[model samples]
Target chain A: MIEFKNVTKTFGKTTALDHICLSIPKGKIIGILGPNGSGKSTLLKMVVGLNKANSGSLSIDGKNPSQETRNSISYLPEIDYLYSWMTIQQAADFVKSFYRDWDEAKYKELLSFLELKPSMVIKKISKGMRAKAKLLLSFSRNADLILLDEPLSGIDILTRDRIIETIIKDYRAGDQTILITTHEIREIEGILDEVFFIRNGKVALNGDVETLREEHGASLIEIMKEVYSNENSQW
Target chain B: MKIANGSMLSTLYKKDIMSMKLENIIMLVGILLGHLYFAYKASTGWHPGTIPFTSSTIFSIVLFVILLGTFSSIRREWNNNTIYLIMSLPVGGKTIFLSKLLTILTQLVVFGGLSVLLGILSSLHFLGSDLLVEGLGFISKYQLIQELLKFVTLLFIGVIQIIFVAFFSSIVGSLFKRFSGFITFAIFVISNVIIGRIYTEMLKLFMHLHIESTRQSISSEFFLAQVGLMLVISIIFFFLTSAVYDKKVEL
Candidate 1:
C-alpha cells in the first residue's frame, strides 16, 4: 500500500499538492481524475519517486520511495521519455536489463499483440505505435505497483481501447496496484475500481467507484465536471 | 533474472555508443584515409612536417572528441527527455553518475590511445627502418620514449580533471529545469576561473607548507603538489556531483 500523510509539495511558491492524505491499497486499479494542472501527475510522480513532497511523508509498502522501491514500481511518465535512437527491440532490452522482474516472454507477447516490430525505430514510429510500445514496456514488468501518468492523452480512440484492454490483460488480479492519471474519465470509467477527484491539489473526493456512483447518483464524467467546474475548486 | 549494476552500466554505455555509432564510423573512416594517405606520402619521400596533422593536431582532435562526447552525453538526456527514463530506473544516483562518467572516460582512453597509435604509425612511416636506431643527443629514442610517456600521462590527468569539471557542471545544471543552459554555462565559466586560481594559489601554499628548509628544492615538490591538487579536486568534484544528484536534482 502507498500512503501519503499530510504530504505537501511545492515548486518555488506554487503549491502542487496541499496536505494530501491518501492510502492506495494493493491489488486494485485506481483512476486519479482531474483536469489539467490539477496535480494528478504530481501525486503519481511522488508515489513513483519522480517528485518529492516538500513536507509530510509518503511511504510505499510502509517505506519511503527509494531507488530500491523502483524495483517493484514500473512508472510510465506522461511525456515521451524513450530515446529516439533506439529500436523497439533495443528499448525493451534496455529496460529489461534494469529490472529483475522483467518478463521476456510477456514482452514478446505484448509486442506481437501491439503489432510492433522489434526493429522499428522509436523516432520514426507513429504516435499510436509509440503509445503501444510504451504500454508494452510498462506492462512487461512484473512490478507490484504500476504508475501510469496520462497513458491516453495523444493516442487515437482505437489505440486508447487497445491500451486499456492491454492494461486489464497485464495487471495481476488483486495482487498488483495500478495508479493511472487521465482527464478522459468517460473512456476509462468502466474499468476504474476506485477514483480520486483532485481539486486544487486536494483530494476532494476518493472512494470505490460503486460507492461514489451510488452516493453521487452520477457517472465519473459528470462527477469530474461538477467537482472541477466549480470556481471554488481552486483552493 | 536480476540484472546487476555492472550489466546495467554496460548496457547504458552500449546505448550511448550506439547513438554515436554513425558519427564514430564517419570519423574512423576519415582518420583511416588520412593515415593511409600519409603513409603513401611517406613512402614517396614526403616529409612529416608537410603533413596536415602534426602531433599537436592529433592531440587537439582527441581532446576535442572528448569534450564533444562529454557535453553531448549529458545534454542529450535533457534534450531528448531521456532523463526521465534514466532516473526512473531501479538504480541510485551514484550508478547513473558512474555510468555517465565511465562512458566519457571510456571514450577518452580508447580514442586517446587510438590517437597515440596513429601518431606512432605516422612516425613509423616517416622513420621507416631507422625508427628505433636514432641516437641524436637529447632526441635519443630512450629520451623520446620517456617524454612521450610523461606527455601521455599528463594529458590523461588533464582530460580526467576537465571531465570532473564538466560532470559537476552538468549535475548543477540538472538542478534547474528552466534556464539550465545559462546556469550550466555560468557555473562552468565561474567555477573554472575560481578553481584555476585556487589551484595556483594552493600549489604555492602546499609548496611552502611542505618545505621548511632552503635545501628542499621547489620544482619536484611543485610538480607533485600540482598533481596531488588535481587528484584531490577531481575527487571532490566527483563526490559533489553524486551529492547533488542524490539530494538536489529534482528529476
Candidate 2:
C-alpha cells in the first residue's frame, strides 16, 4: 500500500502537486487518469523517491521510499530510459541484474512475445519497439508494486492493445499492484478496478470504477473529461 | 556511516565505463603519443634547448580529459534523460555520487599515471644523451622521481578540483527542466573563471608573504599547504554536489 499525506511539489512558478493527498492500496490496477501537467508523473516519481516533496510526507507500507523501497517498486517513465549506447540485450541484462526477484524465464517469454531483438540498439529502435522495450523492463521484475507512467503514450492502436494485454496478463498473476497514468482513458478503463482523476495538482475524483460508473452513469473517460473541464480551483 | 549498495554501484560504474569507452581509449593513447613525441624530439639536436611540451601540455590535456569525462558522465545523463534510470535505482545519492566520482577518479589515476610515466621516460631519454640538467650535475633517479612526484601530485589536486567544479555544474543543470544545457554551460564556464581568479590571487598572496630568505624558492610546506587548500575546497564542493543530489528534482 502507498500513502501521500499533504505532499507538495513545485517548479519555479507552478505547483506540480499542491498540498495533494492520496492513498493507493495494493493488488489492483489503478489508473491515474489526467491530462498533461496534472501532476500524474510527479505523483509517481514521488512514490519512487525520485522527486522529494516540498512539504508533507509520502510512504509505502508505512516506510518512506528509499533504497529498500526501490527493491519493492518498479517504475517505467514515459521518457526513454534505455541508455542510447546500449543494445537491447545489454539494457535488459543491466536492469535484470539489479533485482533479486527477477524472473529470467518471464523475461525470456516477454522478450519473445514483445518481438525485441537482443542486438538492437535502443537509440535505433522504432517508437513501438521502444514502448515494448519499456514495458518488457517494467513487467520482467516481480515487484510488489509497478508504477508505469504513460507506458501507452505515442503508440499505434495495435501496439496499445498489445501493451494493455501485456499489462492485463501480468496483473492476473496477483500480488502485483500497478499504478499507471495516462490521458488516453478508453482503453484502460475496462482493466482498472479503481481510478484517480488528478487535475491541477489535486485529486478531482477518486473511487472504484464500477461504483462510479453505476452511480454517475458515465464511463471513466466521460468523467475524466468532466473532471478536467470544471477543475478550476478545486477537484 | 551511511551504507551504500556495492553491487548497484558497480553496475552504475560499469555503465559509465561502457558509455565512455571510446573517449577513454583516445585519452590513454594520446598520453603515450604525446610522451613519445616529446621524448623523441628532445633526444635529438632538432630542438635547440627548450623542451617543446612540458608540464603545461600535461596540464592542458589532463584538464580537457576531466572536462570531457565529467560532461559525458554527468551532463550526458541529464541530457539523455537517463538520470531517471539512475535516480530510480536502488541506491542513495551518496552511492550515485560516489560511484560516478570514483569512476572518474579512477580514470584520472590511470591517465595521470601515464602522464607521469611519460614524463619520466622523456627525462631518461634526455638523460641518455646527457642533455637533462645539462649545465648542472647528473640528476639522480631519486631526485628525478621526487620532482615528477611533486609536479604530478600538485596537478592531481588541480585535476580533482576541476572534476568537482564540473560535477557541481552538472548538479545545478539538473535543477532546471528546460534550457538545462545553457545553465550547465554558464555554470561550468563562469564558475571556473571566478574560482580560478580567486585561487590565483590567494596563491599569489601566500607566496608573497612566505618568500624564502634566498628569494629563489619557498619551502615544501607551501606546496603542502596549497595542496591542502585545494583538497579542502574539492571536498566541500563534492559535499555540496551530494547534498543537492540527495534532494534533486527528477526534472
Candidate 3:
C-alpha cells in the first residue's frame, strides 16, 4: 500500500502537487489521468522517489520512500533512460545485477513477445521498439509496484497496443500494483481498475473505474470531458 | 538468484570503467606515441634536458584530463537522461560513488605507471647507463630508493586530494536546480582556497617542530605528516560527497 498525507511538491513558483492526500491500495491498476503540467508525472516521480515532497509524508508499504522502497518499485520514465551503448541483452543484465527480483524467463518471454532482439542496440532501435524495450525491462522485474509514466506517448498505434497487451499478459493479478500515467486514455480504459483525475495539481476526482462510470452515467471519455469543461467554464 | 554485494560492486565497476573505454584507449595511444616521438628525438640529439621537460609536460596534460573528466563524468548522466536509471537503482550512494572513484584511480595507475616507465627508459637512452649511475653517485642506493618512495607517495596523495576536491564540488553543485556548472566552479575554487590556507598553517607548524632536526630527517618527517593529513582530509571529502549524492541529488 502507498499513502500520501498532505503531500505537496513545488518547482520554483509552480506547484506540482498541492497538499494532496490519497492512499493507493496494493494489487490494483491505477491510472493517474491528467494533461501535461497537471502534476501526473510529478506524482509518479514522488512515488518512485525521484522527486522529493516539500511538505507532508509519503510511505510505500508502511515505509518512507528511500533506497529500501526502491527495491520494490520498478519505474519507467517518460523519457529514454537506457544507456545508448547497451544492447537489449546488456541492459537486461545490467538491471538484473541491481535487482534481486529480476526474472530472466519473463524477460526472455517479453523480448520475443515484443519482437525485440537481445542484440539490438538501444541507439539503433526505432522509438516504438525503444518503448517496447523499456516495457520489457520494467515488466521483467517481479516488483511489488510498477510505475509507468507516459508509456504510450510517441509510440505508434500498433506498438502501443502491444505494450498494453504486454502489461496485461505479464501482470500478476491481486499480487502487484501498477500505476500508469498517460494521455491516451481510450486505449487503456479497459485495463484500469481505478482512476485519479488530477487538475491543476489537485485530485479533482478519484474512484473505482466501474463506480465512476455508473455514477457519472457516462464513459471515462465523457467524464473527462465534463470535468475539464466544468473547470474551464469556472475559470 | 540474488547477487551478493561484492558482485553488485563489481558490476558497477565494470559499467563505469566501460563508460571510459574510448577515453582510456585514446589516452594510452596518445601517450605512447608522444613518448616514441620524444624518444626518437633524444636518440638523435641526446639533449639531457628534453626528457624531463617532455615528461613534465605529459604530467601536466594527464592532470588536466583528470580535472576535466571529474566534471564530465557526472554531467554526462544528465545529458543522456541516464541519471533516471542510475538514481532509481536500489544501491546506496556510496556504492555508486566508490565505483566511479575506483575507475579514475585505475586510470591514474595504468597511464601514470606507463608514462613513468617510458620516461625512465628515455632518460636512460639520453643519459646512458654509466652517466645515470654517476649522476646518483653522491647518495647510497638505499637512500636513493627511499627518496624515490617518498616522492611517489607524495604524488599519490597530492593527486587524490585534488580529485576529491573536484568530486566533492561536482556533487554539491548537482544538488541545485539552476546554474549548477557555475556553482560547481565556485565551490571548487572556494574549497581549494580553504584547503590551501589550512595546508599552509600545517606547514608552518611542521617547520617549527622540525627546526632542531637535520634537513634530511626534517623533510622526511614533514612529508610523512603531509601524506597522513591529506589522506584524512580526502576521506572526509569522500563522505561529504557521497552523503550529498545519496540524499540530496534530484533528477
> TM-score (0 to 1) for chain A, all models?
0.96, 0.95, 0.97
Winning candidate number (DockQ): 1
Query: What is the Cα root-mean-square deviation between model 3 and the actual structure?
Result: 2.4
Measured with DockQ on alpha carbons, how good is candidate 2? 0.45
Candidate 1 Cα outliers beyond 4 Å, as residue runs: A232-235, B33-48, B52-55, B126-132, B135-151, B206-225
Work out the TM-score per prediction: 0.89, 0.83, 0.94
iRMS per model, in Å, is 1.7, 4.0, 2.0
Could you arrange the candidates by lDDT from highest to lowest? 3, 1, 2
What is the TM-score of candidate 1? 0.89
A best-first ranking of the candidates according to their TM-score comes to: 3, 1, 2
* Candidate 3 per-residue C-alpha lDDT over B1-251 given as tens digits, one digit per residue, 9 for 90 to 100: 34577777888888888877888888899889988888778778868668978976886687678678877777778889988998888877778777878888888888877887787777777767786677677456436667778777877887788788888888888878689899999999998899889889988886677644355543666777788888988888888888888777777
**Each candidate: fraction of true contacts kept?**
0.80, 0.57, 0.80
* C-alpha lDDT score of every prediction, in listed order: 0.80, 0.80, 0.85
lDDT of 2 by residue, B1-251 (tens): 12237777788888877878888888877877776666666666556234435634874687577677786688778778898897787766666777777888888778776776667556555545465466234446335455566677887788778888888888888788788778978998997898788778877887688643233333577667778888988888888887888766565
Compare the candidates by TM-score and give the number of the best one. Answer: 3
Better of 1 and 2 by DockQ: 1
